[model samples]
Target: MTRKASGAPGQDGHDDLQRNLTNRHIQLIAIGGAIGTGLFMGSGKTISLAGPSIVFVYMAIGIMLFFVMRAMGELLLSNLQYRSFIDFSADLLGPWAGFFTGWTYWFCWIVTGIADVIAITGYAQFWFPDIPQWLPAIACVLVLLGLNLLTVKLFGETEFWFAMIKIVAIVTLIGVGLCMVFSGFVSPAGRQASLANLWNDGGMFPNGLMGFFAGFQIAVFAFVGIELVGTTAAEAKDPERTLPRAINSIPVRIIVFYVLALVAIMAVTPWRDVVPGKSPFVELFVLAGLPAAAGVINFVVLTSAASSANSGVFSTSRMLYGLSLKGDAPKSFGTLSSRSVPSRGLMFSCICLLAGAFLMWMIPDLMEAFTLVTTVSAILFMFVWSLILLSYIAYRRQRAALHQASRFKMPGGVPMCVACLAFFAGILVLLTLKDDTRQALIVTPLWFVLLGVAYQFVRRRAVAGVVAIQ
Candidate 1:
């Protein structure tokens, strides 16, 4: 297999995106991707729904996705020409696979970006109650857009700091919560913090089997951007060394960031007492009698949302740039600015992000709108992940020699890929068990239908151009 050029030349003589993202940038970006806004904001609801069982729900999802990432790592390293999963899906499958996978992944980030924008407005309200929600929503979009427009390295630097803030906050929460639990710290509610709180109430399965299943709906959103490292392959300084290091660390990050963090929160505050509408991270601080720290946690959560929105902006633009190179999107999106940033695609994504602000104004109940968009984002992301697995399956069958030669081969091989696909199918069924997610699930197919129609038009135009040239 021949490697394709990483980038095309622009009129300004910039050949491609400079390989400026160092090992540290890729590592932190992977960490940031693993830890998402959903964990901080949505964990409270998950606890209320699944009780202590929610811990298992997170672990289950994390384990399955680790395999998915392993498969992606193997595929990516098999041929460095493959910039992201989008390219591999196209190469292993048909052109239609690339079209659907690329566009859907682009839409996945856009929808998730909108959710982050909505989350940002709500977080801003924590500091400025009287400010219009749209003010912060639109403000976040512009700020991230400006940073992204500067350079890809700037995007990496911004995410590095943003992810660092999240890391510090989670570690502090876990540390503080453990201290409270060990000391038998008593809360204002006259309840003592203890590890026994995990099952002292209604036991681990407090909400029963159905409630455990419901946890997947929102919990899946927490893992939305876990595969974001794949998008940085082109900009990464050392693809062979950096990509695997980033992918291999995912399981450890999930355990520390999601599993242990949630355990600490539940142990400190008990699943029964956890409020569905509030953030457990902030609530745990207040419960520990540190009002000032709670305020600080709110600021951290706000930055987490901003970081996710920034990532969405960067990945969506790159996806569009890739799609345009394949002639699946407009040619202008294939061009880069003087700084080698995909400015056109970046602006287009920002404009779509503004729709979140518009939704805030249009819908009187913001959480309701947030729930709708988040479910849609989760569904679309599952499609992208599924495509990655499918591509791996194709690679194993068609490129057996590549698989045998891979230094970073996926574990369990093709069988694990099939199992991951089955697991995602189960999640889709779980989505329908709830009213809100069910609606989003039903509406998701329409997106693919639209993509199917658009793909035909793109193909026809390409064919006509070839004939005219001949």
Candidate 2:
């Protein structure tokens, strides 16, 4: 996501997000963005696709995006003027660039929000067998609406606690699983849990080169929201310090949180038996002989869903508010309540998510909802990531002089940019091979097409109005 400088002057000297989001909020919000339903529920699919090599797929994507964040950080810190990626897109690539970046990122959250709704119902089923799924789905939407409509700090606070729950769960699982791996704890099923399990099931990429590449298809989606740090620059206090800390440590984050987590999961439960269609975490707890495993995990997954949807609401509203200020969206979206929050934008995004939940219930099977939500979320991520590439290209062309002064410049420069873009393009190709992802791949471009048409209208009006004044 390319961002323009947010410090640009407006008639009122202050745009919508004037107050600084607290330190606790920024840190937890960062965690909130990093963890998602993808880790809890979706990891099984990647394992199934590439066996133990799923770890490699995640690491590869995480590494590439670490570079992207470096590039974004350099630009953002250079001026601290940009509010978000779309803001940078405008400054570097021009107005239309911001329009597309803003809206595309907006779609990213919407798709994610729908997926959260899908997950909530699934979790609810584990607790209430007789309850109709849609009942909880509707309830989740209302909860998200009220949570988001409060204050930005409240949003951050909510995310902080939600993320705290997820982090604690992962850390506990990792610590406990490590003990079992070292203690030689044998499973009740007569299987010994060991680190050797990493390669025991055919040595990493058991399915060969083809399986490794296929893992990329779902793996890319797993890291979709990792760059959300860049988007929060608008509200972050001491962003120069906070942003760099978050982006620089991504490599460590991947190893500790994702790679290690997966390694432990597979070690406890062999790859062959790990249910591809269900959460391997939940299954492992059950394997560990915990009768309450299902209930404990059900709670974890529910909070994970709330965390993701909460983030979606926060981001989508900001994107709209940013778009409106740039004159691409309806003016009302730019309006803030007395609380300095973009209340209209908040309400609008949540309402759209509510509508999406209703549409999801119309589907026959719950699993299909997961595929559909993930596919569209992946596509939205593709667009947002593509914009970051284009923004880098634009930054190089427009501000060559700043390369040296750039506080956090991207290393390897254009070469690295080209390579990362190519990596993303390859993943896009992989999406086509899976029929489920392919539908989203085909339909996603239509969103950009529609945005392009709307942009033309807005651009023409701005041009004509300026001409008349002259």
Winning candidate number (lDDT): 1
Query: How many clashing pairs in candidate 2?
Result: 12
* TM-score per model over all chains: 0.96, 0.94
Error of 2 at 212 (Å): 1.1
Quote the positional error of residue 77 for candidate 1 in Å: 1.0
Taking every candidate in turn, the Cα RMSD to the unseen true structure, in Å, is 3.2, 3.3
Clashes (candidate 1)? 0
Candidate 2 structure lDDT: 0.81
lDDT score at residue 403, model 1, on the 0-100 scale: 87
lDDT by residue (tens digit), candidate 2, 131-193:
987788878878877777777777778888998898888887898789889989888777788
User: Considering summed lDDT, which 10 consecutive residues are worst modelled in model 2?
Assistant: 1-10
Judge candidate 2 at residue 80 and give its lDDT: 65
